[model samples]
Target: MMKNNVSAFVKAVSLAVCAALILSASAVFRAQAEKTLDQMQSELDSINAALSQKQDDYDSLNAQIGEQKSRLGALNSQISNMDAQLDSLNAKIRILNGQLLELNKQIEKLESEINVLNDRIQQALDQIAEKERQIEATKQLLLERLRATYIAGNSTELEVLLSSNDLSSFLTRSELLQRVAENDDRLIRQLEKEQKELSELTRALAADKAELVAKKEKVEQERTSVIVKQSELQTSADAVHKKQNEIEAKRNEVNKILATLDTNSEEYRRQIAFYESQREKADSAIEAYIRAHATTTVPSTNEDGGTAPQTGDGMAWPVPYNNCYISSYFGYRDLYNTGNYRLHKGIDICVSGGSNGKKIVAADGGTVMIAGYHSSYGNYVTIDHGNGLVTLYAHASVLTVSAGDHVEKGQKIAEIGSTGDSTGPHLHFGVYDNASGQFVNPLNYVSMP
Candidate 1:
């Protein structure tokens, strides 16, 4: 009887010892889980801080772009004004040129008329000299006639008649002498009148010539002034043209900077989204693991009530339709239209033709860790396979799965849509390993056509 009692006591002690061990292990697991949750929170805080800094940087760049645009606009307006001024200057120069040409024509006409007047003056001068010579000859002939008459007779005609041989001869000689004196006076008076007319004409022509010369001098001075003004305007126009070119070059540079800023802002937003989704998935995963391991045995079925994938590794194409092509590759990429580089963390698969609301399947059997929007991802979904592998499907129109819902490989989990920063209707598929805390290329795991 005593031996049977000792056996029962031994059994009770063994049972107590087993119960204590189970309790100790459970406490240790729970503590580790709590610590893991704390670490996740810390990581999320860090990511949030980084995201905030990125947002600030993005905002600052936008502000700078705005200022640059304003400056560019002002520069353009100034250049336009300068162009107008230059055009005005050019117009004035053309008018000045026309005026100068007319002035030159006037000067030439004046010079020609002055030359004609000079010729007229010379002809008048020559005629005046001839008239003077004729007057002197006529005067000399009259003087000689007077001397001959005096020498012929010292007394009057009566005395001369007394000395004459006959009355008839004396009468004839006296009549001849009177006629010669009358003819001499007439010729001398005519020569003096002709000489006076020629001298007056010469004076008139000389006055005209002097007036024309003075007018030509005035015109020449005006032309000189106009030329100087044109030169000044031309200098101003050239300076304005040079300034406009410089402003245009600066504007081009600013335009490029604005383009780059836009691209960088977009990239920062994408990175923030990626980090948010990661944090969300981590939270869900920690919760799920705690719940699963809390029990003695792991669940046989998936959280979505589906069997494990037949392909044990759970590697498969995310989309069931084979009519798609890889739109973007994973790595540092040259983004379209931006001419800038970006580190793309996922592969974008798109349909050949145009379509919307297409099915997006799970890449592998896993629990749906997250199904919500996180900025640029827009209606994002994260799936956690049991082996620390996670798949992300972004830009979904609709989510068919919820958190903790298990999915099989190739099962529909979401619908593709142009949400967030998607340029078109496509799915951004990504894979991450929690152990490494980094994304891996999906091609390394899944084979897609």
Candidate 2:
């Protein structure tokens, strides 16, 4: 009996020691789990903060875009007004040109008339000179004849009457002499009248010529004034045309700016879609992991005899669909056959053979952290799954979630696609530890689909 009691006591001691060890392990595991939960909560808070900041940035960008659009609209209105003003100015210039042309024609006609009048005046002067010369010659011939008659003893009218041959003959001779004297006086009066008329005509013609010259000069002066005015108007018109061209150039610049803004807006929308899809996929994965690893109660205590909490502790599949296969695994390697080395931070899955609109599910429950495109990832999405863990989905066809939105596990977030630097239809999945701010292998936390 003593031997049996001793043996039983030894067995009891061993059982106690084993129980103690188990309790100790249980305590350690509980502590670790608590630590993990705290870390997860903290990460969730950080994700919320980041999402808020991103939302603010997005709002500010949207407001700026609106303001820019308004400015562009105003510029368009100004351009329209400028166009109308330019058209009016152009019409005025055309009318001015027509008037100038007509004025030139009138001036030409006036000049032609002035030249004709000058020729007529010159001809009149030549005729008057010829008449004066003929009159002078006739007067000289008459004077010579009168002198010869006086020297040859030809008496005056009374002397001729006294020298008559007889009473009857002398009376007849006296009558003849009286008749000749009367004819001479009449000839002298006629020559004097002709000379006076010729002189008056010459003076009239000279006055007419002077008047015509003055008129021509006046018309020429008017033409010069018109030409100067037209030139001034032409200069003003040219200035207006230049201003119109400047306005047109400004309008074109405005149009280009607007086009750039439009392109940026489109890119932003695409980025938003990509992020939404990623968030959805991450939520779905987390739900799947939770359902698969669910427990009825906390597990037994460890070596320390402490209880452990029930929790999900399994890898998650990034995508909901099972039709795809991984083409590349995450690791450090050279890409594109380039000498430069880089880390392959994500797994590339080929989904080309999958059904159309195959869903991409989330890897965990968390808030959407990033819902846009990165330069390298293209159409990408990022979700913070808490505990410093963030899952990324890239190259999605469509996204259904948004930044800052709370997502549950196993939610459908996107459709698989080949967007942005993808060789084929596939999902590039990655996980990043927020605490380390470095990429980790997605395979460590997510099951392959």
Candidate 3:
């Protein structure tokens, strides 16, 4: 009996020792997992920071573009005003030209009239010269008549009368002398009046010609001014047009910059995709290692594990929040549709606007087959319920269990997050037949409510 007791004590001690060793190993394993999680978190932070910076840059570019567009608008308005001014100037030029044309015709007419006036003045001057000569001749003739009368004297008149030897002959001689004197006086008066009238006409003609010439000079000066003003307006219009071209060129430059930014954005997306691809490979290796070693502690126990589950066709919703909507559906989708006809095998559910901090629960009671990070399904958890049932919950921010841990239906497993290759906070729930190791539609096994 004592030996039996001793043996039993020894067996208990051995079991305790084994338990202690397993606990120590589990602690070390957990510490390694925590280290890995920390590394992933640091990388995630860096990636997030880069994405944020990129977004800020894009926004700044958009703002700059907006400002440039506003400047363009102002420039366009200025250009429109300039165009209107140019049109107005052109109209003014046309009107001025027309006025100038009429002025030129008027000036030509004035010049013609001045030429006729000049000819009239020349004719008047010749008439004045002839009249002056006639006046001088008549004056000389009058002077000679007067002198001859004086020379004959009063006694000569009486002697001539006596010499006539008859009263009738004397009377005829006197009448002839009086008639000659009257003719000379009338000729002298006519020459003096003609000379004065001709002189007046010549003076008037010169004055009229001077006035016309002055008018022509004024018209020519006005035309010169108009030409200069037209040239100035044309130069102004040209400057405005040139400025508009410059603005357009600047707009093109801004557009080019925007295009380059677009290319840079695409590059950032590609870089993220490349890193995710590398992470996916690493995650697969880690999951494989976990699965190979963990299977001993956690059994895949259904004798008919090869068969597909029919009872758990409709299970509980994985997200424990109200107002949640399905972001994506499964079955032959573009999600993960890499060349090999990969259809979406999961359903993504999220709340409107956001789903962060929401709890993720299991659909049914099961042993946690895997609980760790995947590159595509970050901070994920998988459960193996009996009878060939397995469910995966992906894209979690916080994990609450580890491999080989038992969980219950509707129990919280993680927090919804925007991890892995996700655009926002959401849950990706999937189901599979462990027997066939094939994916199944999550919607078929999960009730929406």
Best by TM-score: 1
Off by over 4 Å in 2: 1-79, 156-222, 282-449
Task: Please write out the lDDT profile of model 1 over residues 295-370, one tens digit for every residue.
Answer: 2222243554323332476478877777888988888775432334546778998877754788888887878866
The worst-scoring run of ten residues by lDDT in candidate 1 lies at 290-299
TM-score of 3: 0.56
Per-residue lDDT tens digits for candidate 2, residues 181-293, read 67666666766677677667657756765776676577667667766766776676677567767766776776677677666656554454444334334433433333222
Q: Which ten residues in a row have the lowest lDDT in candidate 3?
A: 333-342
Better of 1 and 3 by lDDT: 1
**Candidate 3: tens digits of C-alpha lDDT, residues 1-449:** 99999999999999999999999999999888767655665555555555455545655655665676676677667767767776886787778778778877877887888789888888998899889988988888888877886897654567769878688888887777778878887878777787888888888888987897888788777877877776786777677668767866776776676577556656655554554454444544444433433322222333533233444454678886678899888866433222223356688999776799799998888789778776567789988776566788888999998888898888999999988768889998987654444556775566677
Ranking by lDDT: 1, 3, 2
Ranking of all predicted structures according to TM-score, beginning with the best and ending with the worst: 1, 3, 2
lDDT of each: 0.75, 0.63, 0.72
lDDT at position 213, candidate 3? 80
TM-score of each: 0.56, 0.45, 0.56
